[model samples]
Target: MKGIRGRYGQMKVLETELDSTVKLLDTTIFNKDNFYNALGRQQDFIIRPLLGPQKIRVNPVNNSLYIIESTNNKQHFTNSEDVYEHLLKHEFTKKNYVIQTVPANNQSVLHYHRFTLHRISSSSNWKVVHHSITGGNELGKIRHALPFLKFNKVVRNAANLLGNYYLACNTIVIEILQNKMGETWITDTILHERNSKWSQFHSLYSCKALRSYIPHTELCTKESLGKFLQSLRQVVLKPCVGQQGKGIVKVTKLDDNTFEIHENKQIININDFAKLYDYIHNHYLSKNDYIVQQFIVIGKIDDRLFDVRVMSQLDETEWIITGVLVKVATKGFFISNRASQLLTLEEALIWSNSKISFDKCVSLINEICGKASVVLEKNCKGITIIGFDIAIDSNGALWIIEGNYAPSTAMFYKFKYNEMYETIYKYINKNKKRFSPHSD
Candidate 1:
C-alpha cells in the first residue's frame, strides 16, 4: 500500500508502513535517483503537482492513488474513483455554500459567496440535484462526472444570534464575535455603553497607550458642549453610530468672540456663542446621539487631510499586518474615507515630506498598529481583523483614530496586494467553522 501527502503547489509521498513519514521530491527538477533513495527497496511511487490545467503522469507498472490539496486543507484517496468522488465533494460544497447578507433585501444575492473557492455567487441555495434516483442532469453529469450521489448535509455558517444574518466572511466576523455585536456593532457598542459617549471612551481608555490617543470626549449635552467649546480651540461633534464621514461637524474657535463650523467641506463663521449654541442644539445635541471630541491636528499631504489605514488579521496563532495604505482625503475634505485616494506606504511617505525616515515610519506604523490590534483583540473576545485608522500629527506622534472591525479589504486588492489579500482569506476559510458563535 502507498500513502500520499498533498499541499498546495506541491505534493509529497508518504511511506504507509514506516510511520507514514513524508518523502519530499523536487518536482521541477525530477530526480529518479532521489526518489529511489528516499523509498529504496519499497514500493516505488509517482508524485504529481496538479495546478490548474497541469498534466499528471500515470505509471502503468505501479499502483498509484491521488491526493487533492485544496487551499483550505487536504484530502486523500486510495484510487482514481475515490479521487474523483473527493473532487465532486469539493465542487458540490463550493456550489452549495451561499452567504445571504443581512436585511434580506433584493440585494441579498449580491453578497452570496462560496467559502471553498473564494468567489461571489450569482445565485443562492443552489438547486439540489438528485442524480441517484434519475440519471443526473446534463450540468450535474458534466460537473461531477457521477451518475449517483448523496449530499444531504446542511451547510450553515455564522449564527442566528443576530437573527440569521450573514456578515461578510473575513476578519470582520472576528470583531462581531469578540464584541458580542452583530452587523449593528457600532450602534450596539454605543447602546451597550448605556447610550453614552463615555462608554465608548472607557472601552478604549482601559488600554494605557490608547488612552493618550483618545481625545477628551463628552456627551453633547448643553452644559458639556459649552464647557468643550470654551476649553478647546478645535472640537468635533460626531454622530455616535454614523460612518463614512457622515454627520461630522468640526468647530474651531477663531477667537473668544468668533468661531467657524466646517461640515462637508463647507465652512460657516458663527459671529457669537448664541449661534454656535443654536447650531449645536438644532443640528447635533437634540437630533442625534452626538459626542464632542477634541480634534487632533492630523498631518496632511498637499494640504488634504490624510490618515494611514492599516489592515491586520489574526492568523492561526498570531496577528499579522496584512496591508498598510495611506488614505488621502479629497480636495478640501476633512475626512479621508472610502471616497479618498489611497497611496502605498512608500508613496505616502514621499508625499507627506515628513522629517522621519521612510523605513522608520513604516516600522512605527506597523508596530503601533500591530500592538493596537493586540490590545483590541485582548479586550474584545475574538476579534480577528482590525482596520486601524492611524493618524500622524504635525509633531509625528502616532494616534489611532479608530478601529473598524468590518473594514473593506478592497483597498488591498485595488493596490495589487493580492498575496496579502489571499492570506487573509486563507485564514478566514481555515477557521470558518469557528465563525459561528461558541464554535471555539
Candidate 2:
C-alpha cells in the first residue's frame, strides 16, 4: 500500500511538471508575437528561432530542411526519431514537445523550431520546446497552440507507450546501414540446403557443420583419400571457412612422373608425389575440413576472365534489381572482383558479345541471378539486398560462384555516375516514405 501510494505521488508530480512546462511554451508563443506575425504573412517564410537564425527550418514537406547548411541545395532529412526516443526513454517529458500545424499553401515554406526554456516558472530548471508553423487556407488567420506538446508529454508518460516498437523501427534503419543481419536464418544443414533451393549448390566443408542445412563433410584419411583422389583426373581444394578467394589449390596428375600444382594461376611442377602429399597433408588438409570440388572452366571476356555481380534489394512488397557490374580479372590473374579490377556491366557485355549477342548473355545472367536469389533467401530470411557473383561456363550454362550480403555500389555508381546515384537516392527516399508518421 505504501509503495503504490509513493508511485502515485511521483506520477502526480510528473503530470504537474508537464502541465507547467506546456503552459510556459504557450506563454512564450503568445507573448513574443513573432510567431503570429510570421503566420500572418501572405508570402511563405520559414521561422526557425529554435536553433537560432543559422538553423534552417526542418519541415519534412518543404524538402529544404538543410538548405542553409548544404551548398549542393539538396535537402537531406536526418532521422530525428532517435533523439525523440532518447528524451522519452529517459522520462524527459518536461523537456520535450511536438509540433502541430495547418497545411501550408506551397507546402515547401513551412519551418520547425526547437527552443530552450532557461527558467521555467522563475526557477533555474531548463526545458526544451519544439514548434512547427504552416500556412493555412485562411488569408491571414492561422490556428496555433501547444496541444501537441501536451499530447506528446502524455504519450511519453504513458505506461504502455509504443516506445519500444519505435525503437525497433529505428534499429531496423540502423541495421540497414550497418549490414547487421543478425543470427536468424542460420539453422540445420538439411533445412539450410532445402532453403537454398538450388540442386547444384553445395555447402562448404567444415569439421562441425555450422549451418543446419549443410551436411558435415568427413575429413579424408590417407587410406580413404588416396582411393578418392585416384578416381578423379583433377580436384581443387578450398578452405571451407575462408573467404575472398584465399587458400585454394588445384592438384592435377600429368603422367606417372609428375603432378601439376596450381594456386590462383601460378603453377609448379612437382616430381615427388610423397612431398606433394606431405605439403597438402601438413598445410591444408591436416587440421581443417577441406572440399575437393570439380574445376570449372569459366567463359572468357575480351580474352580475360570475368564474373558478373548482380545486386538486388527487397522493397515493401517485392525484390527489385538495383544494378549489376562485372568484376574483371587483372591481366595475369583469374579471379575477377574489385580486389582484382572492376568493369561496368555494359563494358563486359560488349566485350563478351564481340563474338556473341549481348541480349543472349544478359538473359543467361538474369536467369542465374533469379536462381541465386531463390537459393539465398531460402538459407537467409528477410535479406533485403544481396550481390550474386556468377560465371558462365564454355557450355553456356551459368554457375553461381558466391553471394555477398553487403555488396558495394561503387562500381555501379561509377559506371552510370549521376543516374545510378539518383536512382539509389530515390529508392532510399521511397523507403523513408513508407515509415512516415502518417503511415502509422
Candidate 3:
C-alpha cells in the first residue's frame, strides 16, 4: 500500500513538469516569426504575440529559472536568479506593462513599477495616460505629495474667505511667499497694501503678506474708497478676482469735468464718476475681501512693458540662480510677462539693453534673492525651490512682482540643462541621504 502511495506522488510531480513544458513550447511557437507569417493579418494575433522565446528551464529545487536567447546570432543563457537580484537592487519589484491605442491609431507601451498609471478617455479617440512613479516607501510618498495637497487646500480656503479676486490672489501669494521667505523681511516689505484689516494679519515681508511692496492698508467702505480715488490724480482699479493682467482699469482725472479710463491701450472718457464707481462696485467688489492697491508705473523698454522672472534654488549654504525668463507684453498690451509671450532673460536683456544694464540688474537680482532665501527658510515649512518675478523700474529699483512655489523646469532645460540636471541630482541625493538608514 505504501509503495503504491509513493508511486502516485511521483506521477503527480511528473504531470506538473509536463504541463510546464507544454506551456513553454506553446509560448515559443506562438513567438516564432514563421507563426506570425502563417497567421498573416489577424489583428488580435498580431497584437498579442508572445514577448520572448520559451527556451527556458525552471528548477524548483533551487527556486531559479533559466532562459536561452540569441542576440547578434549568439545564444546567451540568463538565470532568473541573476535577473531578479538586479531588479531587486534597482527597486523594480512591483511591475506592470500597459499597451494603449490612441485616436490616430498610434500605440503606446509603458512599463512601470511602484507607481500608479491612470488612463482617461478624453474623447472618442483621444486618451490621456498619467504615470505617477514614486521611489522609496510610504514615508517618501507622504513627504512628496503633502506640500502640493496642502497648497491646494490653502488656496481653496483663501478663495472662500476672500470674495474679491485680487484679495484672494493677494492672500495666496502672500501665504506661499511668506512661508518660503519667512517673517523678518515681511515687516517693511512694500508692494501694495490695500484694506488694512487683511493687511494687519498678513503684512508684507511677513508670512501673511501677499504683495511685497505695499504698506499696511486699512479696509475702507465704498464711499471712503471713492473719496480716496478722487484724491489721487491717477489710480489703477484692479479686479480683486482676476489674473494675467485682465480687468485692470487705469483712471486719470483730466480736469474739472472729465476723467480718462484706460483698459489696455484703449482710453475712454468718464463723465459720470458715480456710474464708474457703480460699475467697479458691482463688478470688482465682493462680500469676502478686496483691496484698492496704489499703482506705480513699471519700467518699460522700446515702448513695451516687460518683467524678469528669476528661478532660484538653495544648494546647502548657497543660493543658486537656476534660470531667468523675461516676459514681454504683446503689441498693444500694457503689461508684459503674461504667460503667452515669455522669453529668456538673456533675450529680454539684449532687446532692452538701453533701458537697464543687464549685469547690474542681475547683480541686484541675486542680492535680493539671497535675502528672499533667508525669508523662505524662516517662514515657509518645506520649500526648496522658489521662482521670483521682479519688475525693475527705469531707476533700476527692483519690485517684487510675484512668487511661484512650484515653478516649471522646462525653461531651465533650454540653456541651463547641465545646471538643472546637477540641481536635480543633488536634490535626489539629499533625499536619499535623509531617508536611507545609516549603517554603523
Candidate 4:
C-alpha cells in the first residue's frame, strides 16, 4: 500500500484535496477505487500501462507516472503475456509486488516491416510474433506455440522505445536505405545505378573475365539501334527496369534489309528503316527506359533455354551462396522466370550438356559472384543480399544477365531448399556476427 501510495501520491492527493476525479488507462482502462468517479474522470489525463513486465510507477521528481520493468525479471516473462497475468493477479490486491529473478537467457525483438506497394493509406502490414532461437527440428522454428505472441493482432512500432531491431521485409529499396538499421546487405546496390541490367553492365564491364558474360548493351537511341542491328544480326530489347520477361522484344535482321520483331506470340516485319524505327521507337523504346543488348544463344534443355538464379548473402565477412536454381524458359518465351519450370542445379547441369565440369562451373560461378559482391558492396550502401541471374551460352561460357537487390526466394522454397532458406533467415534474424561497418 505504501508503494502504491508513493507511486500515485501526487495524483491521489490532487484528487482528494480538489475533490476531483482522475483516471489512467493503457490498452485497457485502470479502475479508480470508485468506478463512477473513474468514468467521470475520463475527461482528464489518464495514465495507461504498456504491455510488458513494466509497472506504472511514479517519478517523484516530476510527479509523473512512468513504466518500470526490471531487466532481471525479463526471462520469467519471455512470453510477454506473463506480464499481463501478473497485472491481473494483483488487480484486487491491497499490495502489489513484482518478483525479480536472474535472467538465464536473453532475447531481442526482430521486427519485419511490410507494406503494400502503390497504396495511398499509410498503414502497416505488420505481424508481431516470436521466432525461436532453437526448435525440435534442426532449422529453428517460428514460436507459434507461444500464446501471447500468436494472438498479437495489432501492429506495434515500439522498436525505438523497446530497443528492437527493425527489418525492412518486402519494403522497397528506398525504404531499406532510408531506415538505416545497422548496415545490412539488403541495401547493396553498387551496380544498381538506374536499373539492374544497366547497373550490372557498367559495374562488371571493367573486369576482363566478366566482360564476356555481360552482353554488348547500351541505352536505346536511334543511332545506337541502327549500329547494334548492323553489328549483331539479332539483338534483344528489354526494359531497363523489367522483371519476369515483361516488355521484352527480340529483333532479328533479315537478308532483305528488313527487321523481324518478336514479342510474345506476335511477330511483325518492317521493311522500311523509318517504319521499323517508328514501330519500335514510339510503341516500345519511348514508352519507358529500354536497353538493347547483343543476343547470346543460351544453353537449352530439351529445346528450352535455361538460366541460373543464384541467391547469396554475406555471413560475417564471407559471402555464402544460399540457393541455386535453374529457370527453364516457358514454351515460346524468351526469358526464363517463375512461369518457367525450374530444375535443380544438378539436373540443369546434366540438361545443359556443357563440357565444363560441375565442380569447375560451381567454382567459376562463386568466383564471379564474389567479385561482383565485392564491387557492389564497395559502392552500394546497405546491400547485404544479392541475387545473380546468369546464363551459360552454347560455347560453355558464363554470362551475367542481371543483379537484383530484392530478389524472390520462392524458387528456393519451391525447390525444397528449406535448409538454405532457413540458414539465410537465421543469419539475418539472429545476426550473431560482431562485424558491422557502422560498428566502432
Candidate 5:
C-alpha cells in the first residue's frame, strides 16, 4: 500500500455522489473480527481515503446501526455461528484474502487497491491521477504510482495498496471531460458484460467457437431450478455476480424424489423436491439472483477437485496466457475456492489421475483459455488482462469457469512462484495502454 500513498502530480480531488440504494452502515461494530466490510462509497478520509474515517457498524443480530464514535471501546461481537463456517468454506479462495500471524491485540488491516492513470496504470496501490483525486492519500498515491508510470519499467516496479476498487462507471467523468474539456477517455475496464454471471455466459455462449466450453447456464428461478435439475440432473447454483466460490451450491439428482446439495464440504440430502427447493431458496438464493448451471463432473486429484487459473494479458494484438496456477478445492468441497490449495498446472494434472496426456491437457487448457479471453475482450474493448478460472473434467475436457478483470498476483507470490509473479506484473508495470485523445 506504500506505493499508492507516495503518488505525485498536480491534480484535483473529486467527490462522487453516494447512491441512495447503498446503506452507509455504522461500522463501529467492526473490530478485528468483522474483517470483510467494504467501503461502499459512503465515507472517505483525507489522509487515507479508505482508512475509513467513518466506519458504520451494523449489529448483525438486531441490525442496529452505529457510527464510528460509539464503536471506540472496540467492544464487538463476531457472529459465532454460520459466519466462520461460511468463511472456512471459502478458505481456498483466490488472492482477495490473506493469512497473517499477529497478536490478538494488534492486527494489520490491509486491502488491495488499484490506481488508474490515463490509459491503464494499475497496481495493488494507488496513484495520483491529476490532483487529490485520491488525495490526503496524496503522498501515497505518488509513491507507488508516478514512479512506475514516470520511470522506465526495465529498471523497476513496486507494489502498494491504497484502497479497494469498485465497479463504478465513469459516466460522470466521461460527460464532463468530453463536453466541458473537449477531452475523452475510453473505458479501461470491464463494462456491463462481466457484472452478471448470466450476461457473461450469454456473451460467450453467443460465440460459436466458445459455446462448447461453456456449461449450460440459466437464470435460477423456481421454475428454472426444477427444470434445470430435471434436465441437467446435476447442476451448480451460484450468485449471478460474484467472485471466488462464495455461496456456490452443487446439486445432484439421485432419483425422482431424492436430491443432494453439497455446500461447505457437507452433503444435505432431501427427499422432497419442494422442500429441497425451499431449503435452497432460503439459504443460497436468499433474495438474490442466482444461476443454475449444468455441472461438469470436474476431475479430482485424490479426493479433491481442482481447476486452472490462467492469467492472460493482452499483447498489442491478441491475448497471451502469462501465468498459470491450479486451484485445488479443499477435499470433499465442491466449491474450489474453499480452503483450496494451489499447484502448478503440470503438478495438478499429474496428480489429477486423468487418463489424458499432460501435453494434450496443457494444450487444451491454453486453447480454451485463449479462446475465452478473445470472446470476453471482443465484448469490451480496452481490456488488458484477464484472470480466467478454467476447469478440467473427468474425461479431460476443459471448461471456462469465469474470468476476473483485475486479477491478483498474491497467489503466485504466496505459492513462491516468484518468477511467474514478477513476469505477470512486468507486463502491467509498463501500463502499455496510453492516452489516446478523441476530440470533436
Candidate 6:
C-alpha cells in the first residue's frame, strides 16, 4: 500500500515482492536518488534541512560553523552575495564550510538547518527518543529531550558531544548545498527579541516539540512583504506585541500589484504593493513594530474561517489537554478572537470536511500539544495554564497558530462547556499553592 512521505512532501511507493524496494517520485527532483534512505529511519535523532534563509556564524570556541536561522530571517544582509562572503570569511580550514547533495530541491535553495543529536545510552545509538503515532520529526509529534550527562570532566567539555545546537553537542553535521541554478538563495541570521511574535515563532520553529507547528514569519519590510505576497495568496500583518487581534490586517493578492486588505469589518483594495506597504506602515506601524507571516487559509465551515484553541493545564507533573474549542472567526473576517460561535471538537469537525474521525483528531491534538506544553513551560516561566491556538488546514492537517499565555476561559463557560470552565478554575486553584504557599 502507498503511505508516508519520503521527501518534498511526496508519497513513497513500495515495490512488489519481486522488487522488494521503495520507489521514488519522478515529480520530486532530488540530487540524491537515495534521499529517502538518507532521511528515513534514523536511530538516535532526526536532523534535516530547514527550508528558508541560511546564515553562517563561527562557533569560535570549537572552530566550527553553523547555519544560524532555522526558517525565515530578518534580512540582516541586503543580498545573498553578502551572506556568501560572510561564510567564506569565517571558513575553518579543518572542515569545509558547505557540502552539496541537498535533499529538498537542487535549484537555488539555500539549505540551512540545525538539530542536536545525542547518544541515548552506553548501548544505544544517538537518536530521537520518541515520535508521535504517525511518526517522523515534522508535524509537532517530536519530543523535547537532551541526553542526560554524567557529572564528569569528559561531560564538562561540550565538544565531546554531537554537533548542531549550542557549543559542544555538535551532531548537526551541517553540509551547505550551494545553489546550482545560479540564483542567490536568501540567507539572514536571527537576533532574538523576547515576547514579540517572532520570538514565539523562533522558540518553536526548530523546537523538539513544536517546530512543525510554527508558520514562516519575519519582520515586515518592503522586501519581505513583496516576497511573501508573490508566493502566498494572502499574508497577515500584525503588531509584534498586540493582543485581541486589534491591529491585524489580512492582505489577499488579487492580481499583479492589486491587493485586498481586511481589517475589522472593512475591506480596502489597493493597486500596488508599494501603496499597500505604505498604507499598512502609516496605519498599523506608525508607533508599533509589525511582522508579516505567510497566512494559512484556516479551514472554513459554513463559510466562516475557524481554528482550534486547546486549553492545557498542569495535572501534577504532566501537562494535560483539559479542553479544546473551535474558535469560529467573525463572518467576513479571519480572526477568531471575535468568534461568532464556539463549538466542541466533535461539533465542529462533524460539519467540517476533515476526513479524519473525531477520535483520531483528539488523539492527534493530545500528542502534538503534549510536547508543546513542555516547551511552553521552559520558554514561558511562572505559567501553568496555556491556550494553544492551532490551525486546522483544509485537508485537516493541524498547524500551531500560537499559544495564549493568559488565555480567557469565558468561551468554555459561555459555550455551555461549564465542565471545562470549572476544570480550568479547578487547575488554577490547585496550582495556587505551587506558586504561593501562603494561606489564609
Give each model a TM-score.
0.53, 0.44, 0.44, 0.53, 0.55, 0.57
Off by over 4 Å in 1: 1-190, 193-198, 416-418, 436-440
Model 1 pairs whose backbones collide? 178-382
Per TM-score, the best of the predicted structures is 6
Candidate 1 global TM-score: 0.53
Q: Give the lowest summed-lDDT range of ten residues in model 5.
A: 170-179
Best by lDDT: 6
lDDT of 6 by residue, 176-263 (tens): 1223342221111122223456556644654655666677776675666887989988999977667888898899999997999999
Question: After superposing candidate 5, which stretches have Cα over 4 Å from the reference?
Answer: 1-193, 432-440
- TM accuracy, model 6: 0.57
Worst 10 residues of 2 by lDDT: 170-179
> What is the lDDT for 322 in model 3?
62
Clashing pairs in 2: 187-212, 188-212, 188-213, 189-212, 189-213, 189-214, 190-213, 192-213, 196-375
lDDT of 3 at 348: 68
Candidate 4 vs candidate 5, TM-score winner: 5
lDDT, candidate 1, 1-440, per-residue tens: 11111111112111112121111222322233443332332232333222111122222222354444433344555555554454445433321111111121222211111111111111223222111111234463354322112122111111111111222211110011011111111001011111123333544565676677667876555555667878888888887656677788898889987989999879999888877887766666544567688888877788887888878888765778877778888887777874467777677767787666778777877777776677555445466777778887777777767777667878767765567677767766666655766676
Tens digit per residue, CA lDDT, model 5, 1-440: 22111111001011122222211112222223434332222232111112111122222332232222111222333443433343344222321222111111111211112222211122212222221122124454445343333322211111111122222211011100111122221111111124567556755765688888898876565666888888889999988767766788889999999999987767889999988887887676643557799898888887888888889987767778788888888877886776368888888878877767879977877787787778766555577888888888898888888888877778888775668888888777544534134322
Task: Estimate the lDDT of model 3.
Answer: 0.42
Worst 10 residues of 6 by lDDT: 9-18
**In each prediction, how many residue pairs overlap at the backbone (N, C-alpha, C within less than 3 A)?**
1, 9, 30, 11, 37, 15
lDDT of 3 by residue, 30-82 (tens): 22343324223222111111111111111112223332221112222244346
Alpha carbon lDDT at 216, candidate 3: 25
**Quality of model 1 by C-alpha lDDT:** 0.51
Whole-model Cα lDDT of every candidate shown, in order: 0.51, 0.42, 0.42, 0.52, 0.54, 0.55
